[model samples]
Target: MGTFTHGATEWDVACPRRPSRVAGLTMAGFRVRDLDPLRMVPHPAVTLLLEFGAGSTVLDCAAGRQERGSIVAGPGLGTGGAVRARGVNVECVQVRLSPVIARAVLGASPADLDGAAVPLGDLWGREASRLREQLGDVPSWQDRFALTEALLARRCAAGPPVDPEVAWAWHRIAVSRGLARVDGLAAEVGWSRKRLWSRFRSQLGLPPKSAVKLVRFDHAAHRLVAGEAAARVAADTGYADQSHLHRDVMAFTGATPVALAAEPFLAVDDLAWPGHGTPGRPHVPAGQRPVRGPESAQPPH
Candidate 1:
């Protein structure tokens, strides 16, 4: 675990020692004290939070929904800047799932969540309670992570998987950091444009274009969090210019780039998800041919 202090708050965050066997899944453990209201910034992945401590945590969504206990939020949560999290002496495991694997691991498409933060009990039933107890009884963070990985691996194996083409398209978007063309993706996957759009939206929750923008913004936002100038980040991240970057940032976070740069959610990424900014290949099952995209083509800077 890595300990860091920001302002007057202290955080103990830990990442898994080894990468997860399930692709598109990452887990982190967080122990926080003297907590403040945290702005939940929009990101490209589905988020699952499993609370184990006795402290209380509340998620207030812009859509007028409030939830406690374990929570699952779909992609693009807090896009309207209304999602705020407040808690104290909180201890939990946070999991990030790529949209490609969310269906199988979560037992529902991201579309079902509809950009809302829902209690895990709603999705997992009594199993949610069982998981809470199991995780809380665990002795260490590594054990907790191992348990989570085993459960997710079992769920993914049993549930239905997204179409191979859909998985491939998502991987392409992620690897390109959201710069891949939809038409090109369709051609590469041997699916008509209409088919690809419908399938991708139905299975993964968001449409192809939206996925691209979200992934791209995620990349650019993290760069800003790292103290890079907006102008340089925009140039390197395929934005038309600084103004274009500003518009996208405003649309996604409802905050200016300057304001977002100081957000703690992004700040914690360094400790919770080291080497996470770069997109990696999605885990395709055995006997499946890996989909190829124009990964070698550099985006315009």
Candidate 2:
């Protein structure tokens, strides 16, 4: 366990002693005594929030919809800044599943989420409640992580996988930090543009271009949190200009780069996930961090 403090927000965060045996599966446990209302930032993985504690977890979503307890959201859950999270004495085990494996582990297509949060029960039925109970009963964070991984491995083993080409495209985008020329990737994989786009969206939840923008924004947003200048981040991450970067940030988060720089939601990632910004194992070559910086701003977001 470690303490992650960003501005006035603090959380007792835990990381598994080792990465999960399952590929694309990573777990982080968080216990926040007084979780302030934090804005949701877009991320490129399917997020599973399994809450278990004496207090409650609340998500305030767009159109005044609210969801409590466990939630599963597809990639870019907060596009247009539609979600906010707050809770008291909230303890949860958060899992980030790679899109390639999300369908298998989630037992539902990421496309169904459409980037919005849904109650876990809607997908997992009573097992969601049972899992919540089991998590609360667990004595240690490591135990909870092990239990969670076992469930994920079982589901992933039994569930269907995304097409190899689609998975390949997603990984290419990810390791390139969303700067990959997705347009060319289709040809590289011997698929036409239309076929690739439809398949990627149906299985993974978003179109290739949208995925690229979201991934790029995720990388740039974290750099902003790291106190890098907007202009510098833009240049480094493949935006046409600082204004372009600003627009992408505002589009995804509804916040200017300046305001997002101070957000604790992103700051916690540094401590919780640490070395990598996202939940899965590091995808970048050692020298390419920001956890895989893109090669150039070509096909700029």
Candidate 3:
């Protein structure tokens, strides 16, 4: 567990690489403290935040839904857009899906990728909040992770099922194995790249390669914020060189690694956990701010 700042808010966080055991599932937990108003909403990712001592308002990007209350489960990027948690004192557990992971689980193709934000409730229906309770009540962290894995397995199977390629690519991206190169991955899966692309578009709404880059950038951003040695993280995450890392960081985060790492308004509690283990994770800047640049800054909205 650690703490970081985002704008005027100070966030306290604790995360486990994997949840404690519970009927053979993996779980992860997230907690946030203090509060900051948000300006811009992030891209697609799943966030599960519970209001224990306070409350806030959240926006749903996909479904165009908005709610203000003590929420237990956040919306999926599909429907759940940007959120502004005001005066928040809460515990959150985010179960995020990279494009690769999403494809793998859904059995869809790269061209099917949409990158739209959907809330978990839109997909999981009523059981969404119940899953959080299951994790919260678990006796041990190990059990918590175990249950989370189980839930993912169940949910992955239950949904309309996206392209398997998206999930596969997402998994590779999450583990830093490159974009899974749609053509190469397609051949491995016994399909032509064109066929895979068609399926990918039909299902997820984003191209396979594009999704891979986003997932990779997302991984890099969190690690950079968490204070990993830039060179080391760059190497491990498949950047061709330090310059490559810097380029992407600057493009996506609008800050040099050193600049981002040093910023007081950075918090990583809401970042994604690629694998089931914890320890060498990174932090993320909190609240919404402009994606700054040396030339000009696009203030977050």
Question: What are the per-residue Cα lDDT tens digits for candidate 3 across 217-251?
Answer: 55565577677898988887778888998887666
TM-score of each: 0.93, 0.92, 0.56
- Residue-level lDDT for 101 in candidate 3: 34
For residue 185, what is the lDDT in candidate 2? Answer: 71
Clashes of 2: 0
Give the worst 10-residue stretch by lDDT in candidate 2. 284-293
The residue-by-residue lDDT of candidate 1 on 87-112, one tens digit each, is 98788999988887899888988899
Ranking according to TM-score, highest score first: 1, 2, 3
Lowest summed-lDDT stretch of 10 residues in model 3? 281-290
Best by TM-score: 1
Better of 1 and 3 by TM-score: 1
Q: What are the lDDT figures for the candidates, one per model?
A: 0.85, 0.85, 0.46
> What residue pairs clash in candidate 1, if any at all?
none
TM-score comparison, 2 vs 3, better candidate: 2
lDDT of 2 by residue, 1-301 (tens): 9998866777999999987788787789999999988899988889999999788999999999999999999999988888999999999999988888899888999999999999999999999999999999989999999999999899988998777667767777887887889788776556678998999999999999998898889899999999999999999999999999999999999999999998887988877787768432323211211111233222221
